[model samples]
Target: MKTKKLLTLFLLISGLSFYFSQEVVIKDDKVLLDGKQILKAEKINVLQYSFYSMKDDEEILMFRQMDNETPKYMDDDYYVLNFLTEKTKVESTDFTKILNFMNSRKAMEKLIKWLLKERVINNDGELNPERVQTFKEKYDENITDRTFR
Candidate 1:
């Protein structure tokens, strides 16, 4: 029984180490991946929004930034436009349908998984752009553009 417990503990530690291996650091006007510089800081932009605090029911302001060139940040739409543009042309009206699909729980979970694995968002859920380019390159090809109509 002791041996089994030790084995289980070892497995858990190993799994956790592998899961947390990806890291992002922003410093000196650059973004870094695993301590290596990856991209210029200018590529990123921060955005602000207002939300109500669940605990106090008070309105609060928050900031979230994305890569300035990202589709979600461009043109004031919520759809994944960058992924769409790479595959096919999209019209303005398509944003609504795309937003609905992407907002589903399943879709949100998958995207969040990718984001976490790629270190696009840090543990605090703030923007971490060190791995943004890598995330884009790896996932962009997997996206499929569809028309709601």
Candidate 2:
């Protein structure tokens, strides 16, 4: 009947609206979340392998760099490392390769503690501090020099 068709049409429209409301998109190299620009690079640093985001309203950090020699721009390396390790499974070992290994180890330990406090992973995650330490001991037995040469 006409009533049944109208009801079906209304439901279909509502469902479609809801489904498209949360969609995110990338346009012109900018990341748009819910139709708002969330991430747009303002400057690209090729040597550092980093960039600054255009949006400042978001809770996420905007500045990121990979260079080990230059002074750190952001002071939240501990927090950033924790988030990066949790989200990407990548550690900042390239810095250790260039700088002091001890410094990197200390930073990694702090990152582990931060990850634990944030509860980003379950107890059994392999990146747990204790597990990482044990693994490092077993595999990295020859890395005794902690100071940069």
Candidate 3:
């Protein structure tokens, strides 16, 4: 029957959708990507002094990608910038490294704009200071050290 075929198709589609659903969550020093927790470069702070001492380099900044692709927002409403870090390791990073780091932070800024919009959207919406503060603190922890381009 056509109705039976439609029902089977609907169930298959729903199963596929559920299988692909993802939620972004930061847990401890890592984040869940597509439901898997991976260490975050942005979260891992390399002390500028310590790393430099180990590597004996005078680069102003050092950084690396977190190895996770950024999540795409629902219906392309917004995009999470690939979280980048300039001060990935706090050793003296070179100017080129610094530039790269800056770029990463800039990506974060895009994410921030989207986040702020979300905060304002909730409840028509209220700027919950406590929530805002929490967000600020977390956001700050990730970046706010060196300039991101």
For TM-score, candidate 2 versus 3, the one ahead is 3
For 53-85, candidate 2 gives per-residue lDDT tens digits of 353422221223333333564332211121223
| Candidate 3 lDDT score at position 41 | 22
TM-score of each: 0.31, 0.25, 0.26
Candidate topping lDDT: 1
lDDT of 3 by residue, 1-149 (tens): 99999999999999998786444443443334444542232433321111111122223212343312334532211111221122122112122212324344443323323334446112211234454444444443333234343
Task: Give one clash count per candidate, in the order shown.
Answer: 0, 0, 14
TM-score of 1: 0.31
Candidate order by TM-score, decreasing, is 1, 3, 2
Candidate 1: residue 115 Cα off by (Å): 0.4
Q: How far is candidate 2 from the true structure (C-alpha RMSD, Å)?
A: 15.5
Worst 10 residues of 2 by lDDT: 76-85
Against the unseen true structure, what C-alpha lDDT does each candidate score? 0.40, 0.36, 0.33
Off by over 4 Å in 3: 41-149
lDDT of 1: 0.40
Of the two candidates 1 and 3, the one with more favorable lDDT, higher being better, is 1
